[model samples]
Target chain A: MNHHPTEPQETIVTDMPDRPALLKRWRPRGAVWLAAPAVLVLLLALAYPLAIVVVRSFTDPAPGLDNYVWFFQSAVNRTVLQRTFVVAAWVTLVSLICAYPYAYAMTIVGRNLRLALILCVLVPFWLSGVVRTLAWVILLQDSGVINSFLRGLGLPPVKLIRTLPGVVIGMTQVLLPFMILPIYSVMKGIDTRLLQAARSLGAKPWRAFLQIYVPLSLPGVYAGAIIVFILSLGFYITPALLGGPRSILLSSLVQNQVLSLLNWGRGGAMGVVLLVATFVLLAIAAPLMRQKHSSTRREA
Target chain B: MRNFAGALALTMTCALALPVFAQETPVAGAVKEGSLEGKTLTFVSYGGIYQDGQVAALQEFVEKSGVTLLNDGPTEIAKLKAQVDAGNVTWDVVDTADLPPYVHCGTLFQKLDFSKLDVSKIPPGQVGECSVPAMNYGVIFMYKTETYKDNPPQNWVDFFDTEKFPGSRAIDGSGDPTGGLIEQAFKAAGGDPKAITPDDIEKGIQKLRDLGPDTIYWKTGAESQQLAESGEADMIMMWTGRAMTAAKNGAAYTPVWQDWLVVMDQMTIPVGVKDTDAAYALLNAYLGQRSQEILTEKTSYTPIHMDAKPQVDEITASFLTSTPERIAQGYQQNIPFWVENFDLAAEKWNALLSGN
Candidate 1:
């Protein structure tokens, strides 16, 4: 972290004595100007398209609430929407189960081993999503390696691909890094002496760790849960290839409406529904997250 | 007619499209070589082996015209609608195979200028208000040879009989080749294939869904071919175009060509095209006998031009939809039924796919 080589540049900036005066004059308003380009880009790319979709949901193919009525009336749409949330929740839960011990281990590992653990998470995490999902498809198919291995073990070949658990497994592998990194980062910051103090006060080892460390890790778990659940909701390709028709999600329904059915109004309405559902979930989650955030802050 | 001439003349001098209005116009896509230099046309289709053949068919035409040929899609009518609605129609010519947007009623596709095209040799009733028939492609049931070597499944009844010849099957889930698959399935379920009503759609989908739990529903022609190539399914209800390609590529499949169901996919200039003359020129070239020959040769989809006889290899020959023997049994598309109830069938098909 040494920056002795860059001291000359820092000295040069300080040598220009008017630099402080210039900074004092422009600091407040310069912040807004500096942020303007990013803010404008966000508005154009994100907000504008969203606005079009929301507007189209209401106004397209003759205005009214007909699209909403259509969406609600379709039993298939309701089923798919429910399936999407359920799959997302399952994926989040699966990732948590797989990631918690790995994250805890990472906190207790030596520096080199910790780096190795992170690399294991990152290399696959940075791989193309389509490629990764396709790899899972290869492993999980009926005549795939997993079934072959199971058959070799004198066990009946289990149905994994095109099932709900198959979707969760593929999603968990991709999302475990989200779970691991957050929990690991928070764990790394915790004071280990507190656990020792609990033990010194005659608390059992498991109880001390659970009562102290587990509460401290709640913020990270919540953050990871929020990310994995929200991201899983929007998943399209993995489920399409790896999951069967019974596991069809909301995104596929949206695609069916917009592309196949040529009903953009219905698609837009469906999209607006997804957006509203996500926002409502987020609104409920925000206060819970804030409360956890403040408790963590107080503990720190 | 005068407005067409005016529209044509807008591109160049008064003489450029003058002879286009004459009874003796130039042959389809016949132009002074390089006259269309710097011009562009975007060709859109249900891509895969078929689009590749189309691109090859247009090679000389594109080269001679010196027009920059831009390739685009796996076409969708909704995308065509969006392009037209936005008033920035990038796609010049689009090929729609499944569901043909017959209910679109000439809104998304232009009313093609028959004057500009060479439709003389094209079969009667093949020409529509907004488009020309691209090719005669059959959506037929093809089964893996080794899977059913004992006693081959013969007709739609045999196709739905899972207990007799049980193996995984792949069939069209999107549109179900509209009439062919559904009508056949309806008949297989003991309904009249000839007089298929909206009420028969559920019966058809029910028959399809009854194909057992081992069935996979394919959404695209390419996906169906992938099913063939991967040997992922024992039986596939797929296009002859894809079947031909798959067989040539070493897929072991034999079409149970009974009750041959033939359909001609249509080509159209989208409603708000950039250059009507240029777009028409591409369409004309694509419709020419030589281009049609190459297309039939490569894809085994029957040529629209009556005189274009393609010299296909044995594998391609077996899958050809327009054979005299096959055509004798061929059931042409029930377009009217589909034109009215395409959405209903699509919904039911999707519901069946969702395992409802």
Candidate 2:
């Protein structure tokens, strides 16, 4: 019914009459069977441990809510929790700022350069987080390379290691790829023709990019932010290695309680709180993300 | 079904034949061996060069006793507790801080069988009901020789005296606030280190805080060594072993042995270990003179055995804490006092570290 003018016409075939019969014969039993292994693995590996953690948070040392109470009551625990959120938020924002230009460059670059850029991101990805953190330590420590270079330039060496700034820089570097990849993937899917059309319609290049291209890339930014934010919240090694005593995070507190003090209930309670906070953040972000997506889809 | 039955019968025959194969007993007068035959024990220790030395030291035990030794850890006390609680205790023997075995004695660890162990060679006051001294070391004040060549800091009080020893100082911040830092702090505050009470801990913290922003902390032995090697701090309170390592790596630092805080690691048998007898045997072998000597030679940690004459190079000999003269000069850690007050001290320590 909607044939293109240049197309050669051919005899039409219809299987519509037999569609209901075929649909009636189809069963979901095979699909369910196929998914059974994955479901089992999720139950065993993820759900079981999570359930135990939740239970231990309530029951350990004695069957009471003492652990949760302690977490809320302790000024130190509360401060660390607040600090963790702040650090994660800062890392997410910084990653977003860095990743946007890198991803946009990836979208417009020649194939080889794009591949090279991707490799630059992925090479660090292949390295272990601890190795990357240690590399930062070597670069940022007082006698490390950066300070050495500053001294060589006849400049005073800046304090970098064992500081909040050092932790943020280390986290941002490690989490940059997590932010970039998602945004790049989405930006790659965005049609360039729309921006070109905006340009043709007498809009300037900057306006065309701002009005047309950026709206389409919002989904990628949101996805990347969510991923980076959640990951930064759970980060232990980078912050531990880079941050000073003042820069201690909730995960560090959890590690101290669980590993050093052997206070599992408190650690479990802290973990549960972190988990709930992450869920609450995602819950708040989800509807806003959905609204933006639907509006963008309507405009497209 | 027939094939299954045949396979089962073959397996049963092999099982029965195992004892028969071991029927050739050794001569009565020959060196008695294989006390731990057909047994496997997991030995846990803090990892890195120290653990490497431990494995090397225990090689003779593994060979002579015919026990298969599997190594694991950076020992976590929580993990040990969890394993014991779950009735699946996997770690047979654990090398741990001197305090934990004392604090959790009989609950987390078994009371060591003294009859099975020969503790004669171990230094006096080092052996406990539930643990044996694994190594002798110290948390000694080490300052950059270049910085203080004219007037070096001598004792704990000099370390805390920022005006006299002015540059940035690094102390043990790796946790366990009840360590030498507190002991030294107590001494610096005109309180005797031996007479330290939980109430005096706050005074110690105050004394340390008086050092102000000029003080830093290192959480790991490696970090302590790095601080010295990289010249981050003018003065560093470091473990003797790590100080030695940093010195060997060309850190221009000289140790101040006056009133050095003597510390030791303890070997423990975790409660509910699958084979208790084998664990004791392994512990016994670990404390042997040859084993201690090998440990000292390899790791630069001072040997526990008084008779262990470790063939150390000149550099290593200078750092060894087990020497009779050094031991006489060193201040022994009051283990029982620390053990009794660790939880209270740790809470206060954490709060202080957090700047709360």
Candidate 3:
């Protein structure tokens, strides 16, 4: 906390007479050049396709608002949109519920043991999404291993395929890694001494956890929720396979529009709608995320 | 008669043209004796037997033609559209399902020229101005032969009658409204399958919902086979290949080819393919009877050529709509009707599948 402004230092590189002008002129320009490649990549990968989608959504196959209108008016499209939100909300909630305990465990575990646990959490990362999804098929089908084991014990087999439960189970499986890692990373940095301190002061373990650990780990929770929710919204395969007839998602609809219907404009419109919904969620998340970020910085 | 003279002259011209066409075509895809092939031809096709048959049939062509075939798929139309938009057409030919070519039309696929190939070799009514039917598949009802040794469900009507069958069945959960199963159900219930109106589609879907809680939905061809193999499903409305595979995998199941929906995979050049000559040569090779016959034997799929006799076992031959007797019962999917009412059909189909 040395706040002394007592010493004035002489500039060593004052050989340039216009040093102030030179510094002012060159710094932001240098930063811009440094950022140019990243900006260009983003433009190429993200912005350009998005621009095309937006354009196509507006001007394709007669250049009118018909595609957008079709999306809103079509019962199938409306149902799919509703289903997407429902699935996203459920995934976020489930991931939150499931990850909290694991995240808490990561905090209290020994530092050496935490690395092993973290590795366990990340083991699925090495497998392709399609492979993991195929594994879910082997596990969840009517006569699959899960049902067979259940039935062997004199229990009736549950109709797992083409049901909402199947979709949620498959999706939660696909996105569990996304949910766990962020929460674990945040929890690991929490000062557990505060919980011990609270306990020493006669606070119960649950209360202390609720007051200290839960709030502290919320940045990770928020991050994990957004990651899970956003990813779940765009889920294509799991919902298409495992979910029942009525459980159509926006991604599947976009595929149907492009492939089955052969209407690119309609597909593009659905894509833009999906993108905008995600963007809106992210936009709403920004203020809370910024506040959490600041609280994290302050805690640090 | 003028028709006789015209036919004779046409035959004479084609006889003269055949040798030239055959000789000049493969040279475009000419192989070097002991040198590496320079270019890669990307092939987009549906997975499993469809791809297996196609690649197997074209193996000799690849050896002779010297064009390296880069296989890619479970063909996604959205991916094709994206690639086209990006100005990167990776696939020279895309062997997709029946409905896509009709939906995308000239935008996604090129209008094919039949004059380049010998059309007389092909079956009647398959050569389209825009597309050529490459292979035939049927969507038919299947049941485990062991399930009802004496009282087996025989027809589409029996498939819908849950009371008599008293077991779960598998249908596609892909939300394809006009998926062959639903259409068959409609037809079995005395709705004219060909003249399916919006109301008829609704009725058909209601019939599906009635079949209801006992129904299991399979998403992929492999899943359908697994359903049959595991014996969870006593019966299923399945694609022909899956039914064939299930039987091959020692499942005691057999298909009811009666009133089956016959579908064709069309081979058309996409609108902006640069290698049209190579595409044409590939198309010509694909039309050859030897290739078709060999493909039919290995894969359960029927060939497009009229002259090719498929070498199939009794069970598989019984299952195939291409068999003389089964062919009579099966109906060709009316592409014109589908094309005309595509937008409406798409919307209605989606609604029906979504249970709206």
Candidate 4:
């Protein structure tokens, strides 16, 4: 680990030789062609279709923002959107709380146990999200294996399938690796001597771990939380299978609009709203992420 | 003596079932043994066990006609429309849900050339301008026998009586609301099914809403079937074919047939598909007696052909929606009404979904 803090850059852009030299240093002109195919594919496959969706949101069934208006007018859409955010937030929080300790454990564990823990996260990656969700459905349904076990213990069976908590559990399980890996990598780089230094000086064990270790791992926490949160917003299968009607989220609403109602304009409007919300969220998160991460890395 | 009687019984059953077959001597849609050699027609359907059955149904045709049939799709209208719009249709024959043929008829889906295809053997009034019946099933409900034991829920009115029935109700949440259930609910609330209006949809939704915390809207046929198989819900409204599958899975349930909602899937050719004759031949073959029986046996959907007697098990036989008694009791969905006010009804259905 880089325990020696590096000095800040002393170079200034105003002292650059010329525009051409700076541009060359930034990126060579000849290297531009190498990115053409990827850019073209992105434009055709991603941007072009996304543009049509955005445009259709405005133009279809007569131009203007009527589709968005229609969407907002419906209480169902509002509740679903709210539910989507609430569920995503819960999934992120739960996974982060569950994952942090595990990730921390990974940093401290011996090689064999670390390998086994890493296998725990990576084995699930082999199964598709739908397959995993279906397995969860089988396990979580009424009179399922879980409930049967619970009943065997002489306790009332807890309702997990078709509930918000069930959806959160399914989603958190699926998204745990996203949370764990980033935090583990960041924790691996942080110097343990800093924690020991705090403990030796005056800080108690809890205070030292909280004050020294947590602040340093904030960057990984932010990275993982952002990924888990954003991905959860668009989750369909997990909630659809594990959640009841009360737990319907925004993606399923979009699916209902486009696939069921065949209302592309409304569906496009929902998609555009979700996209804009994500972008705005990223914009707000980026500066906070950068500032805290930079300050934390400096301390480390 | 028993073997002789069994043979005699089989012969008599075949004799009775071959009337429609007798009328079409050369088999109206049959081509010469190798007429379609080197030609390939792509068949698209909602893939899985159902699509597998469809492929099985066409095997005889594939062998006899030498036409290579390829399988693809869980049918999406947008994909079909795109192919037709681009005039590069790869999907030759497409099996779709009930609404698509009627909705996209002459635009995206081709008007059937009945000269090349024969619909005489298919059920009357089901031959749409652009399509023929793929199979017939119903939006039927199965009640857990253990839950009801003695006082089983008998009909739609009882479906909503949570106090009497007193268990969870799993309704079909497969996008569009089932018109049969709506009309039934409306009728149970002292409204006439034949005179159902836009306001009546709201009434029915209210009836469903009254079921309250006990109601669950199962999103897919498989989900509904799962509800039945596991007895997760005391009563589950699902497709007849799915109920059959659940019964096969050893679900202990009794199907309430008081007014099993009439339903069917349709097969249509995309407008710009290549090799229309080859497609027609396959469609014709799909309607034949042996093909219908095979489709029925494999998929558990009742055949649309008038005289195809599938040798199904007792469970499948019970689930068949096309039997004379079931048909007499069946409540046909007001398709014209539904198609006209689909969006408005969807608004109410969505509201009901979110109310919980």
Candidate 5:
């Protein structure tokens, strides 16, 4: 259509060559310069401290692997680590179970109702972790509000404070927002027309949701689950406040070593192990995340 | 550029010359008026009402000595070790448990100059080579009056007797394994409390385990007080000060002072402090008669001054460990034994806590 483009061709030939060369020369340098502050911050704040912890695990009292050896050999440490993972998994699963319907409702709700639902999810996030955990303590403690209500109903007072169920309840409440927000964000982006079309094609509502909508919304579920799990692994305050001595997690162990015993080597070793375990979990989840992202892109 | 360089050089010269000037100044063994002028001392302690009382006790010193006093937090031994290791000690005087001074003496803390500190007024044996007693307190058993209406539990043995007590129990689980707990446990298990050793630690822990699943652990003074006030536990082993506070807060509790564990907080100068003499002067001022009296009145902790008498209410006086009768009934902690066996005991304590 533009075969006779003599004027445009002359302008393009004159302008394109030197400008691109100049841009190409400076672009990479500009990018490096722009990224320098973030890189420097990471090196100073994150990498340096992490390196110190790693080094301290080996060399605090003496230069050896005795700390790590002790960590593995100690039955207490092993049990605590196992308990930490188990609690984290339980919190993740519970958060996901509760967050799924709430997030799905948010995706399909009216504007005002959606805002209200979002506020419900976000208000707890605004509170401090310590304050929230303490609130749970007040509600769950013996002679606390829940126990008083149970007593009023002629029921025996249950041991809720400093128990496993108490910890799960507190952690689930704390991490629910983490699960809901991610799923809501992803669910909001999903097309509702696909579900409607499935229903129009004679599929039942439940069938349509299960066959079409749930599959599409899975990336969000995976993201929420991973995030909640990782965050719950490092939970300190909730478990400390709500869980009993038997509910001591790995973080508590680290605190015990570093603070009480003043054994930095053992504490640092526990920290390194937790960090490695977190990374391994992330590494396993990363491939699934990437695959889901690519499939979503292809569908789009 | 020349002007800036000249100014920088002059500043550096002044910075290097100041310490020399300070060294030439006469050191006052006593906290004389304005002796520590233009100096600031950072006082570190376990924060809360205790630290508030400490700050209150130091107010007179701050006024008289003109040393601007700054306060810092819940003392962490690891942080202190790091500071000492790095030669960057910021805390001039730290309030800590009695055991740390004995454990890290001459390394993390300075061995005191007895001439600078007026140790004559303090109780004998409360003074250490590196530390001086800050305040005296006790870890005593306090039970809900309603739970044991006619026959109240009397001592640590009754505390361990779940069948006799027949209620939930709470104990301090804040820091390292406390020697008081072990001593009490040993006593309860029919072992001699005075003969508690690293060997007896296992049996003590076993006795605690026998107390069973109704045992609750409180990590803070406030939590222990709350445990008593809220009726979360029937019997609470807590500080005398906290138990008093709980009673003041309307908790119907009665104290069992028999074999109560006598504990004391100690103050020590960190190793590489900026001003050693000033820190010693501060410690001296803290042990003053007026300061100790004020501390005892403001906080329910017992005063270390041998002659200081605090005008406290009847309730407060009932909890004070200073009186001769109460002191006779109390048992002093085996600080050296704990300082030596801290690590092993801590490991076992953690293992038991984690239910392994």
Candidate 6:
């Protein structure tokens, strides 16, 4: 608000030091000391375990690159990897498509109504992942609720359990909250006046949304998609329960190797591959996120 | 500013030390200085009758030792690896599936000392280096007695002879990859289940593949029961307890114990536990004849103690697959064959299960 220039030169310069010293002066000594405990927790809880996995990946099971070789060359590993990415991509895209309208409705709706709808979405979110997945199984299994209803209506039951579509349905239901909340938060921040201005300029309602609202909401979409993808990549129970023989994701493969096969080396290697794939995806996403955000803002 | 720092320091101290402080209390001893009271000892186990059975069996231990048992369900190796990798080993005595210890033994599980307890109290050959048998159950054929009133599937061959017993069948699609069901099928097909050298596990898998689209693959015991109860499956390769429950609930199911693939869930102490003795005590308590009887009464599992006998009601007696006749027909999981051929068979099994 203060557009007018005050004294331009450093007339009232004190003995207080420059930028680095100013930062140093404000730094709380106690917080710096307290950071030790927090750092220690991070090391213990997160860093050490990850380091162990990395170390185990190398030295385990007679020590060599046999496990890693096995992972990449083996048909099972390749298939699991392929299946994991396929499932993750589908889950992310589906979640985004389903969540976008729901999120938009939440932002434009009244506060009380929005809260109620959000709570409805979040009730499943609050329910344990296993419980919700089990509910889906009850609903979707061949002789389950849905199929029974269909049968009652003299319709043949569709194969819902142990199929890719079933996996998608269960996973999307479990992950829909992660998608909706982020988009809603981003939508809330968008100024309605921008949409109004677009309309005033003779843009159709859908056109204004596409040109203005959609561009503004991209960051949240990106965030939600990344989260859903990460979560979907690591899905075990949903796929294990609902997914048929063909739907084994990488995590399940890692599980079978470790528990069923008892090959820590191979399992760890598979885990490392999974971790690396996730990291690579994240790496691509991070820079892309920055670029997309900058371009979108520039367009606005 | 000083007050904020003080509060911050206190909060950090509590946050960092609370888990340790809460878990350091000895189970059977007086609380030590700076020890946590009411330390939670997690038991990773399945729910339903099994969970109820475990609780019934461990009631005395809970009283004698002041350890709070936290029940986490079933064997999930991914979660275990995640927890171990995260350096937060939440499970103390995990009642897990048969093969997990072999996978995580020496790293995830503590090397058990059998010298202190009476291993003889266990069945002749059920003890492992890291784990002890929690209970014995099977993935066996269970048919609806009312549906197959003329004649039921007798054995593994009958299960495969679709032309003879033309109806939907359910089989386990989860758990161990190298299950004996397929091997038994191969054996019934005149392929030697015992001669299942690692090289032949593929043949066994092929035997399963031959079962083909007619087989409904049920993931959990509950799912298997659902398959049978809903009339989607006339017969199922089912967990004994699940079949018992289905039968009890008037689902018209009858277990065909012939060539049953019995797998034991063992209660083992994980590595990184500070109180091995307390864990052992719990294990010992779990093995006691009275406890075994109690577990049997509740769960329909044939508990390990040889002398343990429950006063079975007509319903319970009918469900008990451990009857001398049934026991004679059932074949134990070929653990020795599995152990020796684990590596090669494992690769082949994974390939097969993954449909490679």
Candidate-wise lDDT, in order = 0.79, 0.82, 0.73, 0.82, 0.83, 0.74
* Model 4 residue B172 distance off true place after TM-score fit, in angstroms: 1.5
Best by DockQ: 5
Scored by lDDT, model 3 comes in at 0.73
- Cα lDDT tens digits for candidate 4, A109-157: 9999999999999999767999999899989998798999989999999
* Residue lDDT tens for model 1, A222-281: 778888998899998788777777888899888887887788888999999998999998
Over 4 Å off in model 2, which ranges? A1-35, B1-31
Lowest-sum lDDT 10-residue window in model 3 chain B: B27-36
Error of 4 at A112 (Å): 0.3
**Of 2 and 3, which scores higher on TM-score?**
2
True contacts kept of each: 0.45, 0.48, 0.66, 0.52, 0.77, 0.48
Model 1 Cα shift for residue B329 (angstroms) = 3.9
Model 6 per-residue lDDT tens digits across residues A64-132: 887788777887789879899999999999999999999999988998999898998999898999999
Q: Candidates' TM-scores? A: 0.87, 0.89, 0.83, 0.89, 0.90, 0.77
- Candidate with top lDDT is 5
Q: Summing lDDT over every window of 10 consecutive residues in candidate 1 chain B, give the lowest-scoring window.
A: B1-10
What are the clashing pairs of model 6? A162-A244, B21-B36, B45-B74
lDDT of 2 by residue, B27-78 (tens): 2112238877888999999988999999999888888889888999989898
Give the lowest summed-lDDT range of ten residues in model 2 chain A: A4-13
Give the per-residue lDDT of model 6 (tens digit) for B101-156: 65566677776765434445566556666677888877778786777898878888
Query: How does candidate 2 fare on TM-score?
Result: 0.89
Model 4 residue B263 lDDT score: 86
* Docking verdict class for candidate 6: acceptable
lDDT, candidate 5, residue B302? 96
- DockQ of all predictions against the true structure, Cα-based: 0.40, 0.41, 0.39, 0.47, 0.55, 0.25
Q: Which stretches in model 5 have alpha-carbon errors above 4 Å?
A: A1-35, A289-300, B1-30
TM-score of chain B of each: 0.85, 0.89, 0.83, 0.88, 0.90, 0.81
RMSD of each: 7.1, 10.4, 7.6, 7.7, 10.6, 13.0
